[model samples]
Target: MDDTAIDYAAVFQALPGMVALLTPGLVFADANTEFLKAARRTRDQVVGRYLFDVFPDNPNDPGASGMRNLAASLTRVAATGERDAMALQRYDVENPDRPGEWEERYWSPVNAPVFGPEGKVRLLVHRVEEVTELIRARGGPTGGRTRVLEAELYTRARELQELNERLRRAHAREREVALALQEAMLPACRQVGHHRVAVRYRPAVGALNVCGDWYDLVDLVGGNRIGVSVGDVVGHGLAAAGVMGQLRSALSAASRVAMGPGEALNILGRYASVVDGAESATAVTTFIDFDDHTISYSSAGHPPPVLVHPDGRTEFLDQATDPPLDACPDPIPRPQAMTDFAEGATLVLYTDGLVERRGEDIDAGLARLADSLARHREEDPESLADAVLLELLPPGGATDDTALVIVRL
Candidate 1:
């Protein structure tokens, strides 16, 4: 596949119909070529101006309701985060050649919401179709009998549109609730002894921002040790999140009393066998002991953690890897690995989303991560975490959720 970057701004300018991008507050962000041509305006004249300020109601038409009606439709879209199509109306645009002159026109206008990552209406897509010629062909300004028939058709179309809008709103509400639940279950970042720690969780682009990736940091009973883990469940959405919460809680609880990372995962595997939707989940656990300067780790079909030394060397903690949770029919012991670290080493634990790409070799992804770690080995954990994400993720984001934890020793 070609790795060339796409110029979305150029694409938007080339789109066929009359379209404009507006902020939630109705300020014009951009307008396509057709839109500017139809309005007889330049991009410099409209962009960054308020919608009504740019296209105010004509002073000559005392009874003109075009501005009022269009404002109502746009307001509904911004407030409800839904699309709104306005009924046919008479709106006039200024005749650019003639100062203080308004040319009468009719239009079919629609406003749709654009959402940001947190699911709020970040912008509004305002699209308008000029129907002046169609109306004039029917019969002059009023359209005679044709106007009445068109009104009836519009009424029926609006009825169906409203029904579909209601269904979409319900689905959006459910998605928000599920996302909130997952966020509440995730642990907040905390320092591990004198070392700095940073954590980040990002859901996939098309998954409604709901995914089964999670990370945890727990202080062990002894004062000098801490447990950190990252996990990914098989699927996405509400069910996957529920399973993730259960498994995370079980493993966190087991990490306290269990002898090592392997024992803790063994307990979690047993618990996962009984939980619905918990099969085939992958996880990696690491116990960092500041006093002993040692790192004990275990993996359950998860990507290996990377350790970056001060001398610009990178190491993968891959020796303890085993099959995913609940993969074996009967209970069995999990593998465990340990390694010594220098005082200035950085340890990174992450889910597979950070490395895996569709139709690409997994080794390529691992090398990408190793390169990023080596380049930024001297950065603190917070900055290193940000650098890794910026280097590894695509422009739009990954296709799967990512959970990342970085500990600076």
Candidate 2:
């Protein structure tokens, strides 16, 4: 069967057992048919409502522990990102037919965590099997047969708990591998010439901890010059990361011996034409020559680097720009530009993630970056990097990977 064509909503409603979806805040998101039937609730009645609000503790049962026990179990799942298989509990539900009356019920419930990309509990899968009939047949809740059923249910719950633990471990391992791959591909920050360099990389908040965005710094042959570049591949995760590694390495190697940033990018563009998944990738490279007091730069459809003077003036280096990698029908020389910078001026190189936001023009994002850089012009490279990220990214973090490099010249 074509999975994409399958009707997931239909499948969910048709599932054999009672199942419900809850947000981390314990608000009902959805409920399957069996769940609605078991609770005598309509979809409209439960969805978007808080669990406790819909099924408050039985008012007549002065010692009702149902809500307390179930709340504790759900809280555990949310806090720990683990499953909590609750023992059979006596939770009474209001009789829909008789408004003020309550119907005694026993339920075997299990709450499991559903993790988002950041490995946080995004939702809870609440599954339950009502055993009111079984308990009643076994001579009420305190009967010997009821105790035996509880024991059997507990054993099954333990098995389910073990399975959940294994799934969690596997998820953790995948995250570790993604992080290790990212660390391995990206280099450590270091000082180049008299300037302090700071680098930052944040993967998108998702199951994968890596993306196509990358940054590099190469201390050129002469101690007075250093080459720094930032590039973004077209995708995320391992496939994009693999392409990023290849493109970054090519640029680094070319920058070492190429005559200028434009020449290095031309070489990289040619290489990109042959590398799979490199099409439409964008990059910007800058060579800071301390001795000459000049900054030479080039862009392959990437955003211009920002230059912040000591006196709080900001300039965007957009003079030299070109289409993204392999956008040209044939190999051609890329454009380069040179500008002078005074001592203590700071240069910022970053991927689009630092400025791009949903539903906003890129110019707005660039303006925000320029304003932030001007405000923090005097800060050191590390402080400026931190400030830029704090000001530009959303409160929850960016939706895409961001690779940033800051150099104080």
Query: Could you say which candidate leads in lDDT?
Result: 2
- Show model 2 residue runs off by greater than 4 Å: 1-163, 191-194
Q: Which stretches of candidate 1 lie over 4 Å from their true place?
A: 1-156, 191-194
For each candidate, C-alpha RMSD in Å? 14.9, 17.0
Alpha-carbon deviation at 373 in model 1, angstroms: 0.8
Clash pairs detected, candidate 2 = 117-206, 117-207
The residue pairs in collision within model 1 are none
Tens digit per residue, CA lDDT, model 1, 1-409: 3536877888899999999999988899999999999999999999999999999999999999998998898889999887877777789888888979999898888789999999999999998888776656456656744764675477559757876887888888988888688667888765345558988888888785667998888889886899999999988888888888899999989999989999999998889889988889989999998889899999999999999988989999999999998897786999899999999898899999999999999999999999999999888888888999999999898889998999987
Note the clash tally of each candidate. 0, 2
Error of 1 at 117 (Å): 33
| Candidate 1 lowest-lDDT run of ten | 136-145
Error of 2 at 149 (Å): 15
